[model samples]
Target: MTRLWNDPADFADEMIDGFVAANTRSVQRVPGGVIRRDAVPEGQVAVVIGGGSGHYPAFGGLVGPGLAHGAAMGNLFASPSAQQIHAVAAAAHAGGGVFFSYGNYAGDVLNFDAAQDRLRREGIDCATVVVTDDVASAPADQASLRRGIAGDLIVFRIAAAAAEAGAPLAEVARVAARANARTRSLGVAFTGCTLPGAAAPLFTVPERRMAVGLGIHGEPGIDETDIPSADALAEQLVARLLAEIPDGASAAGGRVVPVLNGLGSLKYEEMFVVYRRIARALEEAGIDIVDPHVGEYCTSFDMAGVSLTLFWLDDELAALWDTPVDTPAYRRGAITRLTDAARNASGDGRATASAASVDSTPDADDASRRVARTVLRAVQEMSRTIDTHVDELGRMDAVAGDGDHGIGMQRGAHAALRAAAEAVDAGAGAATTLAQAADAWSDRAGGTSGALWGVILAAIAAELGDTGTPDAAAVARGVHGAAEGVVAYGKAEIGDKTMVDALVPFAYALTEGTATRPLADAWIAAAATAGAAASATADLLPRRGRARTHGAHSLGTPDPGAHSLALIVTAVGSVLAAPEEES
Candidate 1:
């Protein structure tokens, strides 16, 4: 088990601070993440890459010359908020446009798309290429649904090389996408990883057994089998990758880069031994190996796992692969180091936007302020509810998905509670208070559920205007709007075994109940409906998010997202039933 941490919630920020301090010559600290300390030429396209923070060298260590220009680091196993991504992109931007790339996870997609749209609205050109290289995650016919793993290094290197060579934004994006399409990776683990302050590992495997197709986020593996010998494991990895060669690429006589990556706890000596057999296997198949890599490139926090990636190279890609790189973790060829004076001349290059303070409260009357107080109390109740059931939620999610849903919801709820209190203290109206709380929840949590909750709360806040008292019908309309917003934003249906399964039912029941019942009574009935719907999700297979790949494993477990939402709504009903004077 992992040890060492003060306040697990603050671990990511503290780690980033120490990293920037140690790598001052290579990178400088920004609000959201790190950027290269060296100066770049005018009109050079900035290559920004990132994901969750647990994958160390993957994100921050790659921020330097000939690699990512900047990296937007998020919390442990979580995607960064849209505001954080935008900040990193803006700081990394020169006169040229920004190019974004990362693993194709749900949270990363939602936040990156939002930041890309925001940048476009501000007149800054942007393009994206999401890496989908893990062949084990999806079938070849549905390759677009796969997630990225160790192959991130190959794609990031090629794209950053193109950008460094002064290629336009479109060309850089094209090369990155091409590189991703040609790369394939598969991973297996002997044991699961433990998050900081956690009582146990995310999931466990029987002794002498290995889990196959495990994700980097502590997600449970899709299948398991008895352990194999080093040579046999290497052959298995090579055969699986060779089975899914990209179209027009021949395994025989093809040029490929084989990367034997150790997840985290695996020793370099073990990986080298495995790579020896991998090299022999490829050579025996008449394939030529180029720039073979054996070491840690991307990793889980402490997983004893290894993944092998094969990058099929065309002529252009082969040429680009020879580019010199100088980063904190990975380096190639000889390159001149930047002088102290030159590095000193260049500051952080951050271009930050000014934010409004809590003291500047929106205009409101007595009735709206009263409702805002109730909103604050409701948030407090939700936080307490999450704290009480956090462990249970984590256990449920660990059945198939990454076991961080409980911690994520706890982070979001606490952040929202604090923001609501601040807004209430500033004499804000219900709309402003709830809106601020929504932004806080999304910003701090930084996951799929976080983004969805932000959408839901923001829609309701819009319906509950600041000026007058919102009636029962207006409240029902707000709930309906929230349901619509979640559907449009998350793209999940009721039977997808996600939060939508419960949220949609609750919204509909509440709308019908409010026609003849009081607001509090209607909410109580809707909360019961949500609870039943959440329970029913156990019979459905997940069609979205990280759980989709491990569908069979989640057959008897309810989705943690849906269950958490049900819990929150039920808790809020009690707050709404409080005395009128207290509200």
Candidate 2:
């Protein structure tokens, strides 16, 4: 359980601030996250790694001399936004290029790929090596679909070591890919973790039971069983990993880096005891153990669990693994230090400022100003509505997925409202206001829902434009565009039991109703239809994303994403109707 937090919404921000302050000798504050204040060798590839914030010593704590050059930290259990990743990569890039690494998750893949594309467009050489090492998440044939857990350390170290040795970007990325391919991990949880301000854990294992194959982001496990002793757990983990040796590798007589990792709140003694038995078992099986790590490399907030990662070592990988590392958490042998004094003297640690652009507010037409006001009103209503339903939404999401949907929506909606208000105050038009809000929502929330909503808002904003008030037909087109954008971006169909389920029907109803009816009346009707569609998800088996792992356990519960979208659209409909009644 999280005991100390000023405001749940501000936890990530505050945590970063304190982390930077304490580890100033190792890392410096940057726009997206922390970058090593220490200078990199000239023309060396910058190893920029990150994901969600909860996994300490992974995304951020690894940023130092021989690990990650920079980390783009996101909100708890959420992937960093594309803009955030871009900011960190741009700040961290040396003369050579930028190499990106992170866990294999949908949000991380989507956001990191976007950042990589953007960097390439700007003529910055950026390469990505996604870590997929949790064997329990997928079978050997579907190994690419696994999630990276504690095994992230193995892949990250290989890339950073290659970079430190002055390898080119391509070679460094190749080294990382090799490590990711060879690594395998399996995790089990004795208890679920509670997020700050939450009433309960994301999911729970019954008394004397354990959840096996759980994810690092509070995602419930794929299976459950009665809790076992330390030696028994270690044997099970070792057996599971040994069964699937990397392609062209033999489990027996293999040189391996076995990392026994504690998922937060698990003690060092527990990990040590477990690792002892694990090491003895490996030796008996004729496998030679290389450098073994036993501690927290990755964490899931305060989840009471542990994971074992086996990184099968080749000659090249063994050399990379022996390289020195110095970070906020992990440290190794001596390396050249780039003191902060020298960094400050050279002005290398400060964020480079960009030239200001010309203001676009003056281009807004008078009619568009009125429409922008309405958009602001609806945004305010959405903020209020999300606040009211945050707890309920979390409860619904806890039925299968990680139970942060409500809190995520609250953060996004509030941030969106603030951004929209600022745009409106600046005399911006409808498109600009909505676009600004969209960016804020995605950045502040930092999850799959946040990214999808950002796409949906941006699609609508494109049709809103700046010159004049958009008509019913134009607005309907925007709604339809939002539906299309969400489906395309999230890759979730209507029957997949996601927000797209409600969005498609709402857009169709709005377009059909607007053929003759007023915008307000049509919106209200469409919103009602969306609400019903959201409720109907209770009967559909989830076929996409995280909920799919939980399967039948998610049945009888409305999809949280669809429910939240329905709530927001319904609130906005009322806001739209208010203006009509006043007129």
lDDT of 2 by residue, 1-583 (tens): 8899998888888999999899988887787788887877679999999888878877889998889999999888888888788888888888789999999887788788888988999999989998999887777888777788998889999999999999999999999999999999999999999888777889888989999999998888999999989899989999998888898688678999999999999999999999999999889888999988899999988899999999999999999988999898998787878665777676564454231243566469878888999899989999999999999999998888888889888888999999999999998999999998998898788778888889888889889988788888888998999999888877789899899989999999999999999999999999999999999999999877777767887899999999999999999998988864463
Query: Model 1 over residues 1-583: C-alpha lDDT tens digits?
Result: 6688888889889999999889988888876788888877779999999988898898999988899999999888998888788888888888799999999898898888888999999999999999999988999989989999999999999999999899999999999999998999999999999889899999988999999999999887778999999999999999999988897689888999999988899999999889999999999989999999999899989899999999999999999999899999999886686797765576534523233233578799988998898889999999999999999999999998889999989999999999999998988999999999999998888878888888888888887778788987888888899899888888889899999999999999999999999999999999999999999999999999999999888988999999999999999999989975775
Report, for every candidate in turn, its global Cα lDDT versus the true structure: 0.90, 0.88
Worst 10 residues of 2 by lDDT: 349-358
Reference-based lDDT, residue 301, model 1: 90
Candidate 1, poorest ten consecutive residues by summed lDDT: 348-357
RMSD of 1: 1.6
Once superposed on the true structure, which residue ranges of model 1 sit more than 4 Å away at CA? 344-348, 351-359, 580-583
